[model samples]
Target: MMTRIKYRFLPFLLVIILFVSTLTAPVSYSVQEPIMPDSEEARKILEDSLSIVEIDHEIERITARQQELEVTQRQLRERITVLEERIDERRDRADAVLRAYYMGERDHLLVMLLSAQSLSGFFRILDFYDMIIQNDQQVLQSYNQQYRELQASRASAERNAAELAQVKDSLLQQRERVLALQQQVDGALNTSGNPEAMRALIHEFTLYWENVGLYEVKRHFQALASAMENLPGFIQGSKNILSTNGKVYTINIHEDDLNGFLRSEDKLFETFAFRFEDGKVIASGESGNLSLLIEGRYSVVDEPQNAIMFEVERLVFNRLELPDTTRRSLQDEFDMNFYPKQLISFLKATEVSSSDQRLIVRMELDL
Candidate 1:
């Protein structure tokens, strides 16, 4: 019975020993670590980043050039606008002057003179007559002067417009070139793996830059040529005429008065006018005699005899002396005339010598 009891207690003792061993045993657990994505995907990400950086650099370069072009274009446009405004102003002034001259607003002077009734008034009338004459002269002078100035301003505006057009055209071409370059760059970026595309893009950029350089060179040459062509005229025209000690060499008055003076009237008449100084005319005569040559030919004032005759090529009004009765009516009509100071100066500089029977004047012509 004692052996049987010990066997039963042995089971309980073994259970107790197993529980104690379990409690004393070191516990270990394995946790599986997740595998990272492939390096190729990461390399692609890095390549994309590099591509973006390259694209950003190209974009910056393009933006800088675009800004520069924009500024240049703006300046050119402003200059053209300013020139246009000036032309408009000058043209308006010319129109007003011409209208005033045509309307006989200058006749107001005669009215003022005639209105004077007393002896003092009569004296005042005489004084007014002189004043009116002076004013008439001034008006004609002003009108001619303004007309010439208007012509000059118009010419300048035309030049500026042409320059602006050329600039705009060039800018457009440059923009196209830049756009083409950008497209190439974009294509290369899209095909980053393709070496040939990248090389072609770089070549395109080089060619675009070269073209830009050539455009700049051409612009410089054109500007130089324009300056050279206009500078001499400006210098000669701007000289002081009052300081020169010379007599008026030519006095060409247009007959029609409407067409004004032209440079192509006739060589003989034009040359004679160019040579005849202010004091050279010992006698002056005008003939209304109209003659019909052979059949359908028409001639005015027979081909002047031995006397060197010059046909008035252009009539430049230096002064006007209107009748006292019509002065008031024409007052406002004549203004802003252009006096060809340079031409006048050239005429004044001519030297004249009188022979026994004829007067000879030396004149110079600009080619």
Candidate 2:
């Protein structure tokens, strides 16, 4: 009987143990954390973020200029209105004066002078008629002068209007560019973890671009664009410039190009010679027995948008790869962001690529 009872209780104990185990089971979540992008993709995303920052700066500048144009245009318009009103009033007075003199006589001044009754009275009437004629001429002269001033004022107003229109168009274009950049950035960041850190890194690299590298390149491109306006003189008689249809142009740049372009700029890049090989940008330099090599990879990124970017991958000094901290510090200090916005504004870059011993940008001819 006891054995039977123990077996019966054993089944109950098993049931209780199973219940306990079920209650104590570990919990698991079905959703997974977002993973960061691969290094190459992340670098492209960084470039896009930097583009956003550049677009924001452009928008801010355009907005300020737009405001100035608006104010100037308003003031000019007011001046034009005042001038017009003044011209009209002056014309009315001149017309009244002329009408009173001419219609009062309804004949030549000679007739009026000859119609005097006595010789003495005729002389006096002649003097009075001469005085009226002189006054009428003065009125006409004053009216003409005022009318000329009105024309000048109107012309100024028209010039202001034209400039304002152009400014507005520029502002609109910049705003559109910023929107596109932001959308690209948003899409990129959504797939990325630690958005703030990514943004900070991008901002830091942008500072590098602005302060350290390509500053001269940017200024020269801006000046050239401004000087040319609609003229495509940049490619004329230039060996570095290549174009087939004059609508699409390619320019291969190298150490010589940079050296010529920089022309005595005190930058670390001056000592380096750059070349492309197997989709990588390699720079080698030496200074007083110290040798350095910087390698970057170039790729066409298409997720956020179709764009080409160069990202620094390795830094070797004296034939040894530098530690990560030193590499990162140097990269932040001397990141070579090669997107020339001024040049792009004139000739839109269609494709940017790299190959063995050559880095080339294929661009639409002009704006």
Candidate 3:
């Protein structure tokens, strides 16, 4: 009976030990973290960031240059003002001399000569009149010289002022470009960093153009269009474009009012207003329009609410023809502007025909 009772107690003791061990044991838990963007997309975003920094550097350089030009202009203006005052003073002196010569000074000399008691006195009086006339002639000559210098200085100042105005215009354009590029980069970071968002953008870009019988080589037009809103009024014209081809192209503005866009990049268009004859595309040097033609074109599609499209059929990345520094900068800009989120603002601002047929843009570059 005692043995049976001990066996029943053992079972109870084992249950109590198990419960104590369970309370003393350590507990652990884990959380799953979301995946970041792929290396390629991250690299692209980094590249855009670097490009923006470089563009900012260029803008700073341009701003410094503009400031220097303004200082020069101010100095020129001050020089002209000083010269004008000198000319006026010299003229007044010359006029006084002329008045003295014309106001019976000769008569006064003759009367003094007649009143002289000795011949030597009369001779001395004649000499004094001659000296006075000589001094007047010298003063007139000096005044004429000063007048000529004043005119030359005025002309120079005017030229300098005109140059300063040009520089000012350029500064404004570059600032706008910087803002547009910055906007594009930010949009890319938000969209490209997300795999789903990027896929959706690619799908929409492809679907819209494919429905209209055009196949885009790449989906970058959205990126370029996104920047247009931050752009100045003139650059806003490069909106609502759909590229069928794969290459990148340059945009040329024919309107004079729109010239600020072209000039913003340092008069790259020169004086020639490049016209795209419906199906042509081209790219030119940043220095001037006539330096070299990389061959590009742009066109407007009237069917989709005046969509302006730029297509580069043959794009040559890192052209050896361009300088090393320029080549790198161009590559940076090309890469930065070719992303999906870039220039989307310009596309959205378009006046589309229907809700289903909203504006689409694709800007692709081989960088």
Q: With candidate 2 superimposed using the best TM-score fit, by how many Å does residue 329's alpha carbon deviate from the native?
A: 30
Residue pair clashes in candidate 2? none
lDDT of each: 0.39, 0.61, 0.50
Candidate 3: lDDT of 254?
Answer: 39
Task: Please name the candidate that would achieve the greatest TM-score relative to the true structure.
Answer: 2
Model 1 worst lDDT run, 10 consecutive residues: 290-299
Better of 2 and 3 by lDDT: 2
Q: Per-residue lDDT tens digits of candidate 2, residues 225-301? A: 23333223333445755555667767675546544444334344456566766767776776544456668776544
Q: If both were scored by TM-score, which would come out higher, candidate 1 or candidate 2? A: 2
Q: In model 1, what is the error at residue 363, expressed in angstroms?
A: 30
lDDT of 1 by residue, 302-333 (tens): 12211122221221110111122122112222
Estimated TM-score for each candidate: 0.25, 0.46, 0.38
Per-residue CA lDDT of candidate 3, range 1-367, in tens? 9999999899899999999998988532132112323466654544344344445656676678778878887887788788888888898999898777689656787788789988998889878878977888889999998888888877877887787788778768766776876687567756754756654444443233233211111122222333333443434455533333435433323333333444454332453233333344343333211123343334444444334434444332212122122334333444322222233333322221111212223343423
Task: Report the number of the highest-lDDT candidate.
Answer: 2
Q: Candidate order by lDDT, highest to lowest? A: 2, 3, 1
- TM-score of candidate 1 against the unseen true structure: 0.25
